[model samples]
Target chain A: MRYSLFVGCTIPNRFPGVENSTRVILGPDHLGAELVEINEFTCCPALPTFYSTDRVTWLVTAARNLVLVQDKNADLVTMCNGCFSSLLKATEELENVNKCNFVNAALASVGKQYRGRLVRREGNRSIYEPVRVRHIIEALYTDFGREGIADRVRHPLSGLRIAVHNGCHFLRPTTRTSVDDPAKPVMLDTMVEAAGATSVDFPDKQACCGAGGGIRLQVPKLANAITKDKYECIHAAGTDAIVTGCPYCLYQFDHAQKDLKVHPIPVLHISQLLALAFGVDAEHLGFEWHFVAVRPFLKKVDAVGVV
Target chain B: MTPGGAPEAQKKRSTENGSSDAKSAEGGPLIVEDSVFTGAEHDPDFVKQIIRYGGKDVQTCLQCGNCTGVCPVSLKTPYKTRNLIKLCQYGYKRIFFTIPWICAGCHRCHEHCPADINPAEVFVAIRHIEVREKGVPRFIRDSTALILRHGFGAIPSDDIKRYREKEGMPPLPNTLPGYRKVLSELEALFRKTRFTELIGLETGEGAAGERKARERGGEASK
Candidate 1:
């Protein structure tokens, strides 16, 4: 139940609410999952921009973060889809003997080694273990199933309609990350439903939020155009809010709605929703930091007597 | 595969047609030189490098339009993922300099690719080649610069800090101790891989210098 929380770069800086809500919900008083922070961890280096540009450096950097978690002897749980994919992909690729040797040589220059899967002798026997990396959503879904999560909800979000965005890297490159089915993902929806909210099944539910691959930062017009499509679909679904597991997607939906001049709808991370359902104060969850105001959604949640 | 291997009949027709004045309506047909097929142009090394860089499924690409059909950016941009894959497989590395940047990395293409090509990863490989030879795009440079300076890609500003504090969270949560050392080590690693040069950090010579160096290296290798 213990994990080295990997809050990637964007979540901590751009979306502190995600970090705050995750900590609050997973704190000992709540779900009670032991969340440890490894300060040595740097950016997941972001897959599309950094990892794509320099594969060797990306592997080494991701391996360095993994090594830090290994130092803690804890499984890595990432809140950002980019970080989860980068670290998990690196961990999976480094399992190859040749790739492992290559990355280890690079790591050695940094005074680190990626002994990814290690064997330790315990008395007359040996135990082989590989580092486990999971996205926070997957960790929650697996650790606490629908009923388990529902049992923890003090105030159910009875009538709220939420559109779930699973973000690309969360389910994609499935060969590298088999967290959920790439095409028909239901874990995010399942988690959304567990909070007693209606998980609206919208068209293109699996589409990209347009923030991936640094698109939102670079060619923002195109990014906003893509985001507009997602918004249009969500709006058509008449959802009260958009809920996502990744911070980048949350940022995209939150900011792109304003940039595109679409009617702003509240966007919440799964942790924030869980915290709200658990009767945590809205002010404590950092809703004010959001570009799109969460008042409308908060009012709805409050109307449901969840606040 | 022979260079300038046009049929003799066509050559004679071109000679009779007066190729110099062929563009004029009064003149005969234009003589088009056959494109030379050089071993240097079709580099298997580039293909190998793409696979080496994690585009392991690039070779299995069936040239299906599934990637383009599913690509969201392809609808608005000139970045057709399938075309990029085809070009990458054929060792046309220059197309990747800007095309791959258009990819949003949605993985929709990866999901629908009948060949399991993982066009997203192929784009990543193309981006790797692009960065090494042609320098990274400005957006990538900016992101890398932030990470190098703050140990995070996005730095929380004073306004953001104030907001975070109001939300019952520390201004900077999980600030790594001695991040300066971490940045230095990361810079060293970038230098070893020439990433700093690609992103215009260490040498201050920007991508123009990297492009010039690559052109010179390409000529030398030829």
Candidate 2:
């Protein structure tokens, strides 16, 4: 159950609480999965950044990060969907011999090369074992199934109604992925229910949070407009809070509520929710950095009491 | 429907009405205007560049509105991916620079496209073309510079650092800011990839700052 923890940039920079909660929940005492933190690891070079402007740089940088993961000899587990998407796409691209060689040529300048953990060859085509990149939800859902999660919940959140935002990159470009049904995602919802909260279906459940692809940075008004629709839908559903696996979505939902006229709802990363359900206090989860106060939500959890 | 199916059908409907300004069965004006058939703005190489940059099967797009129907940005903005792809196939290179940047890159259109057009990937190709032809946007340039300098897309603020310290975690996670070797390696990779040049950072204010830092021998090593 050991894996390399790729927090990417957002979790550590904007929300260290996610990193803390993730480590606490998956640490030796909880899931007993050992997380290897490689100091040499850099950003996943998120797709919205270099992948859009410079494909070669994006592929080379991502290949370098994968080289570090391959050196660790463990599957890469990321808390950010953007990281998962970039690393997974890079792995797919690097499977081609020509692209791999081209990236290796660039890597040579930095005294590194991407071998891709070559496994075998088939008719002049080299089949390399791509590094398995998984999102935190996928790791949690697969490694510890719904029953495993339900069995461990010490503080059941019975009265809570959650809107699970799967985030676009987690289940999209659906042709290459099989984690869950992209259109009607149930992994996050089922996990939310496993933790004792009722998962509510919202109108904009599958819509993008409008934070990805530089929309939040470039045209924030449009981003806010898109997020506004999502907020209204979730607010209409009467959910106590919004839960998501992607930091970008969490950031957008948590921060965008300030401008919208809808009621402010607390946004939580899935790890933060699971951590609270697993009996970790709010103080340890780094809820202080959130744009919206989490105190009321904490009080609600307290009122629910232990099951 | 095939690639040319849309225009051919439009031409047939207009000829049946015996006028260029044809009325649809619904008694409204034609959706696509006659100006679209002029090919005055067409640049065939744009489509080839898009295909080269991993925008697969874009030419096979049936001009179906499925992409626009599923696009979240299209819902709010004037950025319809269906129209953008149509323009791309029609070889309107300049149009890509304006509208493609509005894409939020959700990839929903890619998921729902029956033609397997992958409009999201097409948008990325257009973004690359935009960056090369026109300079990177302010926020993108600033963020890319941060990655070049700190080996991360973002840097934690002083308040964020204090919170981390209060929480009994390292103020800085084990990323580039914490390791000079990793930062240097990333800088070398940046040079090798010509990322700075590609993003327009090599010449202009960005380069001057680096030059000045090197002259002072201050943060260049950083």
Candidate 3:
């Protein structure tokens, strides 16, 4: 389904290629971006809820976005695992009879209304949808007459043995919205394979990238311990690079790798790698969003070159 | 109705809740006693049940209040983990129902124990007794049903979610997503292991949306 790029605040602000690269690579392949605009969308109320206990207004404001998406009948997508969880959780919760009334009434004062609909967060996070669409929604619109995506791949990225790190929130989140086995999740690896790169099998493949919940903020020490194991797993995979779908995971892995005494492997968002492989310009793909600079590699050919 | 009402009540409750200058209130312990002679003393048979289930360890509790100091629920509510232990040690069964539901199962108490006793385990024992002997509160019973059915835990239904959101709730990620995956794998890896069954995760159909849920929790996918 053609979906809106419902990005959470982080993408447009901090790590932009999240959308820049997502659009650059996915655009040529036919994933059209329908941006969802809530007259005024606010934070999903994630941090405050952890310190104080409230869900009604959080769900109410969250539904404001949902109503906007439902107005267009497009699928909701977001790059933030947290926003994805909040929007989906808020939508599902607001749809319930007993629950909807209070949240809707709360929304009334804020001049927002939720009409029992779900909206995707912008820069839509990776949804492990059950049906695999080889060509994105944009591809359906833009690349209809062209050769399928496979034939157009200019660079196979064949020799790359990639390690896939599924961020904690992507799946196996404590509250919900995960699409794979939290313990042995395989969605990200599967996607990496679909993109024509070999997803290396590793012992800690299912471990988190240490960017989860409020762990990074609330307890950096604890976050470190979690990432420590994740780094070890990635190291064992002996891959050419690390590929993660979540922006936060990408950020955390990059940051954690910066101070490391060992392990200088590069970290790339799945889309950036895909864009580079598909013949998109490295400069345009927001390669600069990364804190840890990627190792320079000479491309054998341009991304669009069929040979 | 509105979620605000409870916070107002909680605020009023807090005036009473946090109002505790415990040293001035009771001097010895800010505790409620069941020794008012309700014609029921500790049931030996029930005490036997406690021992059979491992609550026999609570019998040695020194009443140091360390459990009270670090209780997961007590920090949130006016719950007294030490007092609950005393009640169990004194054979108070009526107060047993409300004592342990708030325990978060984090094992923090066990780690801090001077006696190597697990108050968390004792709390679990209380839950077990409630499950096996006395019936649990409907909400908790349903929550357990959903958890056991789905293999992960649950979140408040839209009712609570809306209330919480209106209250400007913090972002609390539900454990179900991670737990469900963890349980699904555990179910497969430990198909024959009783630990899976002991934890009440036997199947993964907990993902099934039940129309029966009223204030029922949300079922999530990864």
- Where does candidate 2 clash, by residue pair? none
Give the Å error, residue A140, model 1: 0.7
Best by DockQ: 2
For each predicted model, how many residue pairs clash, with residues at least 3 apart or on different chains? 0, 0, 55
lDDT against the true structure, each candidate: 0.74, 0.78, 0.50
Interface RMSD of each: 4.5, 4.0, 17.8
lDDT of candidate 3 over A100-206, digit per residue (tens): 76655655554545554333455665322211112122222233322344454556666567888765445533232345555675555655555567888877565
Model 2 stretches astray by more than 4 angstroms: A117-128, A173-175, B1-40, B170-178, B208-222
Q: Tell how far residue B41 is off in model 3, in angstroms.
A: 27
Give the Å shift of residue B82 in candidate 3: 18
Model 3, B113-202: lDDT tens digits are 687666755765666566545543333323334433443233333433443344332222232244454334323322332323333234
Better of 2 and 3 by lDDT: 2
When candidate 2 is compared with the true two-chain complex, its DockQ is 0.40
TM for candidate 2 is: 0.87
Ordered by TM-score, highest first, the candidates read: 2, 1, 3
Better of 2 and 3 by DockQ: 2
RMSD of 2: 7.1
> What TM-score does each of the candidates earn?
0.84, 0.87, 0.52
lDDT of 2 by residue, B66-177 (tens): 9899898778755567877877776666544434356777778877788988898888887877887776766566667777666777666666667667766644644335
The ten-residue window of minimal lDDT in model 1 chain A covers A171-180
